[model samples]
Target chain A: MPAPTAEQEQAIRDAVVRGFDDQVRFLQELVATPSRRTDEADAQRLMARAFEDAGLTVDWLYGRGAGDMKGGLVANLFAYKALRAAGLLPEGRVHLQSVPEEECTGNGTLSVMQHGYTADAVVISEPMGEALVRAHLGVIWFDVDITGTAAHAQEMSRGFNALDAAFALIVRLRELEQHWNEITVGDEHFGDQEHPINLNVGVLEAGEWPSSVFDRCHFSVRVVVPPSLGSQRAWEQIEQCVEEAREQDPVVSRGHATVSRSGFFSDRYVLQPGSEAEGLLRELFSDVAGRELEAFATPAYIDSRVYGNYQDVPSLVFGPVAESLHGKDERVNLESVKRCTEIYALYMARWCGVREG
Target chain B: MPAPTAEQEQAIRDAVVRGFDDQVRFLQELVATPSRRTDEADAQRLMARAFEDAGLTVDWLYGRGAGDMKGGLVANLFAYKALRAAGLLPEGRVHLQSVPEEECTGNGTLSVMQHGYTADAVVISEPMGEALVRAHLGVIWFDVDITGTAAHAQEMSRGFNALDAAFALIVRLRELEQHWNEITVGDEHFGDQEHPINLNVGVLEAGEWPSSVFDRCHFSVRVVVPPSLGSQRAWEQIEQCVEEAREQDPVVSRGHATVSRSGFFSDRYVLQPGSEAEGLLRELFSDVAGRELEAFATPAYIDSRVYGNYQDVPSLVFGPVAESLHGKDERVNLESVKRCTEIYALYMARWCGVREG
Candidate 1:
């Protein structure tokens, strides 16, 4: 298919410029209506209205998941609306989805793919600072519970220390991290980098009094998986690491430390380096920025991974610059949002084919 | 210098029986009064009245210490009164002290000792059942502050995890506990026991969320010191362990983890076996219980450690049976209090040399 004519591209850019106010209001309102885990109903309603107003079919996939996809959903809605206002409706069907349960689970997006929501190529529109995200690392969360015998600190011999067990587990995890880094060094994707994958111990709590030996200690860890490693393979490696740790110390083994998955999992998403979707996204990004945009991978999972990996759809992540996402003072830049809309319009017309009225 | 005559003992025991109701009331009120750290004034007032009524000079040593010594103070006051009533007032000076600040600091007792309150032998009436406490362990409390570079977990390499440092420190402390136990095994007072010394990690806290690398972790620990290892020597050994831990890992070394004493220290107190004080107390206990009382060292610290170690007073812990001292439902047995009063009366007649009244 041929690229949009210069006159047509100018019309779409002008439409995006005109819709700048609405784009800002849309993003601000979307952000104001919080869509945290299991509370995305209001954000979903907002996205559905925006999509329907844009004259596109809207699908709300509901489930129990953390709602980090709201910002991306709103961006996609406004991008579609801006294009339609410019009289640049594409001939191909544009199925807009406001998916829930993508943060803690990818079942929402997975359900959408299972229900036959297919596209030649898919753009996720998650906040990526406009440098198209072609890859994202998978994540697995687990809780480690370390048990020990509690006694007055005076009777140290009678008491097995749970904090000791927790410390042992952490040492083993650090060792596992080093081994993982060494082994994944030669892979084509996510290889030979400073930190391609990571194991993070996020939260920890132990005994109550310094006068008593700790009877129980608990900690949670998040592990980033390279695209080459499946979640099952990563989990097996972690279990083996725990076993090795247990073998290294009689006290830890006696303490009965255990590790269990925390019911949250996301598979690694990688767009092939030379895929058709990658080529189109690169061209559109260069057109919008007047220069080539660099592509990079994140040690974070996005909703796009579901459609890309599960449905075999060529999916890529592209969005406006957003700072501190999922944290305090999170925001998408207004100007970038407008520029993104123009690029999305141009990409839609070229990839989906412009309809003759 | 001779043992109390059977008739004299009978008169003292009868006097104790007469004051049984008052002794019960005194202990009940003392336990009822809230004398938590830094709040011993009310309890002190009650003891002064009881001691003065018992015809003994009363001294109030003021400050913040473990209020656990109040029960022992009341028992001594009644014992002196019963002996005086039985015409068994000792010729030697019988100074009754209601000292404060034995929980967190020993300055109260230290101040009294500094003020020239002298004794041939001091028997601290702490709650230790009928057994003679000839030796007790010391205690040292310390705080560990672990510092690490804080960064988003996505950027794992840029962040040095504080929890990791904490884990390394705990591991080091466990090894120290083992080493301390081994070295203290040959101690004459607390030798070859299962646990003569101990290290307990009581309180621990780390990162706020399971999603970010922890930047700071703070925990407090309590270490028991055998009589052989003084507080200063134990502290030096602990510092050395931390230094060795810092050398083991680059992240921990870079994190600048620090260990500092928490200003609460107790030195181990051990009375020589077969001393005049020990023999007199043993004879009195055997006469009351019709059996021998065993001598053992305790992991817990007491106010008696001050008089024994600081004042050159040959102090031994001998008190009535009490359940759960310094805890909820703390109670001293009424019968034991009566029996203890009788024993104290006899000890006063024999050890202090009864005057010809």
Candidate 2:
């Protein structure tokens, strides 16, 4: 694909500068709406209107996906509007989709794909700074429950402490973390990243009273799965760890503890290096930023995995840098948002073929 | 001391049978008052009135001790009344003292002792079924504060997990428990009771958020010290254990964690097996119950430790069997209360010498 001409690039830059204020206002308004999880109805309506104003067919796929995809959705809308103003409309179709429930499940994207929305190449704007995201580690969240016999603290020998079992499990988890860190997936794309697999024990709770022996304990953990070790293999490894722990303790081995994937599970998604969509995204990022865009895998799970792997569309993640995302005072950098808009416009023109008027 | 004459024993038995109804009513009323800790004013008033009714000089030392001593207070009252009614008042002065704060500290008992409440021997009525408590383990409650750097779970290596530090401390505590249990106090008084030393991890808490690395963890533990080890030696052992743990972990060794006795501490109390108070109580229990009373040490801390060790009084715990003393549905056997009254009356006649009216 040919790079945009100097005059065309100048036109695109001029249009982005002209529409920069509107893009900022749109983003701020969308973020201010506070669309967490499935609460994205207002944000969806705003994006749908913006898509229509940019002359693209819009589909409202009401769910959590709409919230996660909002940043990407708004950036796409403004990029299209800026391209049209510069007489750089792509000849191919641009179907803007706003889906739901993508944070917990991929039902929204699935429904949109089932409803016949198809694209040769897809770009998901999940906040990943300037580098294009071609792959992400899979995630599995689970809870382990350990049960023990309760007795008076004075009769220590008569009771089993569930917190002791929890400690045993935590030790096993630490060992598992070390083992996974030692594994090399042999993926050249990951490049110098020693360990992509991580295990986070997020929440733990046990024993109601200090004087009585704890009878029950429940803990939840999130495990990051590398592309080489998919969710199934990772889960099997966790089971083996639990099995080993059970063998070391009489209370745990007496069938007093259980491990279950009751929370969330998703497969790791990786796009082959030099894939058409991935190559196009990398080139566009480089062209827009005037620097080489390094590719790397993230431990975080994103919607691109759903679209690319499940929906069978070649998808990549490219977005602005947002510090402390999903935490206090989360804010996206406005300048990066504008730069991302220009890159999206150039990619559409090159991949979809520009229309000559 | 000579045993009570058969005629005097007959009179004591008859008096106990005659006062059985009043003793039952007094115990039930005392238990019904629900004087937990500092809330013992009502129970104190009732016991003071009962002591005066029994023709004994009563001192109301108000506080938590009033609640703990209410049962003993009521039993003492009715026993004195029964003895007087049967012409069995001891020649020596019988001063009934109701002190407070015995559950927390010995301030009330100390105050009473300072105020010239001296006795040849002290008999404290703590519920121990048919056995007489001549010795008991001391207790120390302390908190360990572990501080660690807080970082996002995504960058776990940058922060020390306080929960992990807590686990390391617990492991050390378990080792200490095993070490203490192996050392025999070599007291025939305890008699084949294995593991007089016990460590209880009562309360544990750490990290507020499941997704963030825990930066702080605080846990409290209770340790039982035999009469041989005492509170000072037990505490020193705990400090040494913490120091060992700190040496093993760099995070802990950097003074990121501290162990301090912030709550409660009490020295163990043990009366010589052949002391007048212990021997007399054992004979009285055997004479009344027609069975040899067992002498054993308990892990729980009680006010007898203060009186026997601190006040220079020969004190022993003897009382009725009560299920769930400090828990819900705490109850005492009315028949045992009657039997205990008979024994107390007989002891007054034999040890203190019955006063001639």
**Using lDDT as the measure, which candidate wins?**
1
Q: Model 2: which residue pairs collide?
A: A63-A100, A63-A101, A64-A100, A64-A101, A65-A100, A65-A101, A65-A102, B64-B101, B65-B100, B65-B101
Question: Please, what's the RMSD in Å of model 2?
Answer: 8.4
Which tens-of-lDDT digit does each residue in B1-357 have in candidate 1?
Answer: 555677877888898888767765566677677675567788778776766566532112122111244555666787778777787657788877777766556678788988988788887787677678878888898989998766546766667788778777777887888888887777777775777667778779887655567778989898886566789988998899888888987756876889998745888887778788888888888889888978887877776777787777788788777653433334556677667777877788888777546
Report, to 2 decimal places, the DockQ of model 1. Answer: 0.30
Candidate 2 local accuracy as lDDT?
0.69
Kindly list the per-residue Cα lDDT of model 2 for residues A1-357, writing each as its tens digit.
Answer: 344577876787788778877776666576666554456687677777767666432112122222234556677777777778887767788776776655545567778877878788888777677777767777777778988665545566566777777776777887887777666456654435765666766666666444556667787776776566778998898888898889886656653678988544778677666889888877778777888877667777776777788767888777876554433334566677778888888777777776544
What is the per-residue lDDT of model 1 for residues A39-66, given as tens digits with 9 covering 90 to 100? 8789788777776676431112122111
After TM-score superposition, what is the CA distance of residue A47 in candidate 1 from its true location, in Å?
A: 8.6
RMSD of candidate 1 to the true fold? 8.5
The estimated TM-scores of all candidates read 0.68, 0.69
Superposed model 2: Cα runs more than 4 Å off: A1-129, A173-184, A187-193, A226-233, A240-244, A272-280, A320-357, B1-129, B151-154, B175-193, B208-212, B226-244, B272-280, B319-357
Candidate 2 chain A lDDT trough over 10 residues, lowest sum: A57-66
**Which DockQ-derived CAPRI band holds candidate 2?**
incorrect
Q: What's the TM-score of chain B for every model shown?
A: 0.82, 0.80
Best-fitting candidate, scored by DockQ: 1
Q: How close to the true structure is residue A232 of candidate 1, measured as C-alpha lDDT?
A: 86
